[model samples]
Target: MQIRCNQVVCLFALVTALAFLSAACSGEAGSLAAFLTPEGRQPEPTQTLAPTLEGEPAAPAAGTAQAALQAAVEALQGTPTEETVAAAGGRFPATPTAPLLTEGPSVTVTPGSGRANAWVTVTGSGFPANVRVDVYLAGLVSASALAAAPRSYATTFTDRDGNYSMSFAMPSTWPDGTPIETGTLAVLVATEDFGFRANTSFDFVAETATPTQVPPATLTLTPNPTATPVPTAMPTAPRPTAIPPPAVNPYAEVTPLSGGRNAQVTLRGGGFPGHSVIHVYLGTFDAQVGGGERVRYGSAVTESNGNFTISFTLPATWPDGTPVAPGRLLILVATEDLSRQASAVFDYVVPTPTPALNPYAEVQPPSGSANTQVTIRGGGFPANTRVHLYLAGLVSVSAAEAAPTSYASTTTDSAGNYSLTFVMPRTWPDGEAIESGTLALLVATEDFRVRANATFDFVAPTPTAVSGQSWQGSYYANPDLRGDPVLVRADAEIHFYWGTGSPDPALPNDEFSVRWQRSLWFESGLYRFTVEVDDGVRLFVDGNLLLESWRRGERRVLSLDYPMQAGQHTVQLDYFEHAGDALIILNWHRLSDLAPPPTGTPGAPGLLFSNHPWNNQRGVNQTFCSGFESECNYAGCVRNYRLVWGPYCREGDYPYIRPGLYRVTFYGIGRVRAGATDYGSSRQLFSFGQHEFELPGSFTFCWPGRQSDGYGFETIAQSTGVYAAIDWITVEYLGEQCR
Candidate 1:
């Protein structure tokens, strides 16, 4: 039997073989002739054919590929674990997931006839936009092969219209030779989110077979004088033009990104000209902001495999996160030569919830100002036991305490009630804004990931002149305010901008203070005042000390929000420099200056984060580097930081969601450095927003309410100096939850 094993059955899975074997053994066998039919006849779809008596083929088990793959894997190595999966770049999973889609997507070809590896323009619709799909080619003896066997290759995604069209060269791996008379190209889309999956197929015209050649006739003996053999010219077809290879479209993913600032996001994608530089731009969704408005974060060069990954600190240029940040920002990645481009959206901030943190916690009176008391209550908690409180950002209900983050801490009452007064942290550890977008208040109890959180109002007051006026500068002789400075200067409504230079020329290089005194007016509402300082600094409003810090060679900030009347108030900023260099920056803002608020309120912090030794230790789990293992392990270096994302409360603690105003505070010990100078001894300094405590330090996230059965929490503490760590995160709860 002329069995076309190489072409006629290029992709026969064991399914067809086993079925044929069973029927043959059961006295109802179909002959191998079913598949080895003559050139003209078509075979039935259900008819199965056995391999030749030579040997069985290496056909993969189709209907049970998952189970078969599992058994083979176990026999060879061992069991699969999460660690192995994560290290595999999330591309492959040991276990097969659910089916992609029930109704398969379809593909159509333009001018369908083409030779092997020729460019064919295929259009696809009815698929989700901006998502990836796999494209490939396969061949068989007849069109019936479409239902029997298949394979896939190259990956792509759809456009905003859920449509995609590309002129792609056929994959070189396509089967050839005799039995593979017909072929088809296919597109495959699959994802874990929302169970999205689809496959589209289109047939390609078959190529003409080679003509048989004839040998010269033995006519020498019959050749007579009168019949001299006439020579004839053979006909030759013209050569066809060669086609170029298909260019790969760019594709990438940015990790730990939420369209927010201070985060170091990673963009990873491939399929470009190898080793080429890519010009990337962050612009409005499907819109490009021109000239100055355009912010190019950085550039990346593709590796030899057309894949490149670069890390960058997310810029605060788009102050608001996600929706409000001029809608969604489209990240356009293009080649350096200004040739090809590929783009993706920020649709995914966090990964799909693992069916664990659904039904998030909710709180009343979600947003408010400092010292404002609120309630944190949620279900899924046992009654009558104490539960630990942890603060975090972007509350997604999970089963762990959000630690190794800037969330402050507290404890709930026996009835699962905890009251707290709001106190904004002076030392916000995270580089991202505590109030990115509207704010998502995430609250979680100890040993439980379920968090209850709420938002408070920005409460913008009437318009007021936000500029500082009647400014005065003075220098002190001693680091201690023992006497008045030697030199002084003053400016009416001054706009002073300086570097690490000295404030006064007459004063010495170290232990000098430059205080700016002015009278500022405000509308009848809340206003935020921010000051950036180096070394020791202090601020007083209306003769009341609003913030203070005493440190040397450290950059710190003191930010505060308070209510004020329509009249002018006295503002005094006390600043001092010790040794090295110094810098001071100040600013103010109100809520009305922002764009319209987002529709959905954001997360809030009702958890805690600190280096405080809990359970007779610092963290339930200890990490050497930046605490965030994902980034640290990837970079292959351990930074000077420790982290915790928690279930801090032990079981049976029964942490109650109490009611109160809450705030953030932190303290740590580390060595300080002077600007371009070395300080011989250790110095102490304190800071809030624009000030820092050189020796001891403190910070907090805007606190949040408590909840149950959902929200996940995270925390981190880092230092640039010679090893700095936060001591404790405490949220001052000030309300009644008893009864």
Candidate 2:
């Protein structure tokens, strides 16, 4: 395998101090050694260490080591100094021998990709029968084929047929943060103890794929007695054989898929025709593979035993030099004649997690009642990995349900707990909400390992009935210290914004008064009452005068918060209007939502009344007309004629009060017929009220309840009969002030 030249240069630089250690160990630095290693004795170099792979951080080169050695050698000659001796950051080869087998009885790994702490089956056959086989796993740094001396992981004797199999869990790390991706499966089969040992090796690296079906065919291998001593080369020609089909078929295996670039991986499988030329395909397997998403990795010939193992270096690019990125790579093996095939997968990139995560999970309010929201918080789970949660009754019968399928899944957050929340249903999917009891909730990673659980009792939510009582409205024909009402009816709420419509068709719309009151339920907490009214209005809670705007032609509102106790209380509203549009809106809230929001932006929770339509743009100078309510046609253009209305229009501002329902009532004259003017047509005794927009212009609110444009509502001609009149303007706050 070829390593980038740049890496070679860096590796040597980091190992310059190694020279001092070597020379001092030979007694060459008896006195100058203190200068070479000021802090402590320099350490010796390690043999069989992982070589830096293609994509690793650059290490200093042999040239760097030579230069540092030269500098140290000169310093020890007479001008010795710590600076000259100390240098930081490789293996220099002493000799090279050709690998024993170009084609050998090789190792095949069941799983090509996995986390460091996963077990894989290593199996190979056709070695010296009954011989001792020493197996080990070691990662390759520079290139899988370059150099390696892995530590022994297992020892076993081959069966009389010269076949051996062992399962080994991969170690979780490599030195210097080097990823554990590419490695060699080194097998030493010795004729006797410490005697001549014939070595058979194969390389592998992490690389992905799924099985894509191909035309079916079978492989049959006839072992050749001449293929002896295990590592000797056999015939490379193609030969077909007729044989009985074996009970077990052939399977493909590639090792060490969690690797980076330019490493080697070996492909091994059995039960192929003797001397068959097998083809290999690596990359995305397309249904129409001949055209795209696939490129041939190359081919190999099966030995006489129908078993074949071959090693090849990974390329940094496709056949066309399209750079191979860190992702998935498919491995496919087939007969050159297209008579047989098998496939496997390797996830090319073994990415390091951003945060070194640990496992922790918890369900808040572990013992909450049922039908309420419960949050399951977890921290340090594998980032981006899917997590599944299972709910089950804690009983011996629940064991079968522990199967991986019995759960719901969600992805984990990056670098933190995988937070999951859900409301327990009134009953379990099993239809059991045992009158009162607890159920077990378990959480496991998507792969279904490492489970954590908690138990909490719960109950079903029950419905409550509404109090049938509502507002009772009364009407009077004239604006005065009123007598008995002309009309009376049951009103659910005090939100009367009707214009021109009389409390009764029998009563007149103009010059009228209305009163409404009801009993309501309240919780013990801060409460607020918001009322929008026109003309004159007064409000009383439990007979206490909370707010009043008892003046004719006045348009205003009431808003504020007050403490309240849990119980039923009476609310009453008295309203009267001399003429024009009339409206009233009442609403109540609790706690922080009590105060009129910082700035009035319409549609805010506290918004009692706003004449302007919501067009998104608010608070800012309403210069551009993005098609406001009336002038919507000139959208996207600037219209200095702003359409916003202040709470203090021609009318006064809204009345400030506490959080509670207020009785709101309004009175207005009906619209005049077209072409008619004022309360009565000119030279005529009969006239009708005017529309609110036709009555006067509204302005934006100023500080302390004044129109930002100028004084009160722009004066206009009056109408004798009833019609509409805006009670107030609004820029109800969104929550807080935009400014």
Candidate 3:
């Protein structure tokens, strides 16, 4: 059987060879004899072979398609025999070495030529699959021009086959700011990063002119596997029909001609009493200058030329205070004596009811710490109605619906637009500090019937400083950093010249402030930092203030030279622009590699630290309690006599305190513990006083220069249950005590 199959395969190979030779030699295209046998008989139809014995290897059926194809491949390689055919189990595998295929990106624009604002369809193929691709229209078809081309304002995502289609109106100008005219422009489709791009051309013609015959411009399209097809005939856009305007009345006319109640309208007419007051009224033509007056809208004085124009809101009530029903009302323009009267018909139809929409609100910044002045805006509610805003958790809609007192209330405008600003509460309703990065709900509603919610992200209050080579800059709209930053970004340097321009659109050119901070590493050396400012600037290094000029000073230069250790250090600069020319430039240079002494008579004596009872204070582990019985006034304390007791944690007047012991004095009526601590804990605690008596004490600790920014002296009452009052405390620089 194998021998018979092998013979049949050889015969098939011979026949195929003969057929190819005859066709090539004779130049006959597709011949019917190509599938015929040697005797000119039609070939037999193919059929599946039957199964053979289980133990024995079955031979392929004679004259089968598989046998003949196997015979052809083997013959092309070398030869085929009965033993080889039987060993192969009558079937051979398909060719493994097939050609690899690939494709490149391409784009096309429909109705390739058009004027500005003409809608055009753009189709792209072979783009990055399932990714957003931007389409742009350029004045020039060059790589250099694409960078500045105006976008087509269309974006689309490619399908799995990397094809997308979108449409956008054509722009008027090109990349060079020139008007697109009588020339071919490039249409570009590219990813956001411009990693992949394709370009085609568009002919821009004048609006009233026809597109003349022109040569196709060169396109920047990638090669694809298949050849792109060209359209034989281009499509023409249909001309838009022009509509005739409504005829205007010769004697008098209203600009809009018709509107609902309260709608503003402008009436213009000639031949009215000049230099005279014109009383406007909404009524019928017969009612004007006759039986009585009608609904009198305000009056206006006419010009000297006897031509008058009056703008007023449509009245909704008559002169007798009765409601004016919706109908066609005439606006009568006449003098007080009814001498010159002109009338124009105004159709006061019923206002079309607005379609219902789901109410929604959004908060600017979307996330912030406590006291962040959140601006909430709402829409799609009842107009001229109050909307209550609440801060709720993400428990459920039911939980938010049951909130008691609203955080704030604001009324929507006549167009159903609501907006309000409120300070975010420091804690939740349950008196818990709002956790950082927690999701909170901000609901806006009118009696809960029309309610909408938005998510507010609660971030930590204190900004965590990060280490970088550049400055992390924050810009605020106000001089004081009281609200969310207008702009937060990384700045490579602290040089700016915002003479009449602002750092950000949200901030004003004047009265704006900025804070830039960065942790930088440096080698042990003495560095000189210089700053030239128009207004004021404060520089701090590792919490130690090196320069302080927090005032409105004209352009001035300040420099400070300090020795720094070989490690990481933080630098911060705060500047404000009050008015006029604004500019600030900060720079630092290592003066020398030599390290200076830690302590010495570097400068003249100056007051270092003083604590005020009513100044800005932070509480730790306890809340402050105010009492009328305790006193607050002292020589170095706030003038107010109110008393508050808690952790009297006050930052000293100096952040980077020099190495000095100096003198520490405490005058207060309370038990107090004072020392220099990192946070609120001190190893060398100086305890003094009894709760029932006034304690005046003084003590000094070894002065050790701080290497970082936050180490400072702090004081806390021994117990909050007792009367612990801090009247005055001062730290004076006695001399170089550490060295």
Best by lDDT: 3
- Model 2 residue 17 CA deviation (Å) reads 58
Ranking by lDDT: 3, 2, 1
lDDT of 3 by residue, 681-718 (tens): 34433332123224566655544444355334343323
What TM-score does model 1 achieve against the real structure?
Answer: 0.22
lDDT of 2 by residue, 508-609 (tens): 777888887777887766565666777777667777654545666445545544445678877888888676776777787775322223453432335443
Which is the leading candidate under TM-score? 3
Error in Å for residue 532 of model 2: 6.7
- Model 3 TM: 0.33
Worst 10 residues of 3 by lDDT: 620-629
Better lDDT candidate (1, 2): 2
- Preferred candidate (lDDT higher): 1 or 3: 3
Q: What stretches of model 1 exceed 4 Å from their correct place? A: 1-469, 493-501, 556-558, 592-739
Error of 2 at 601 (Å): 45
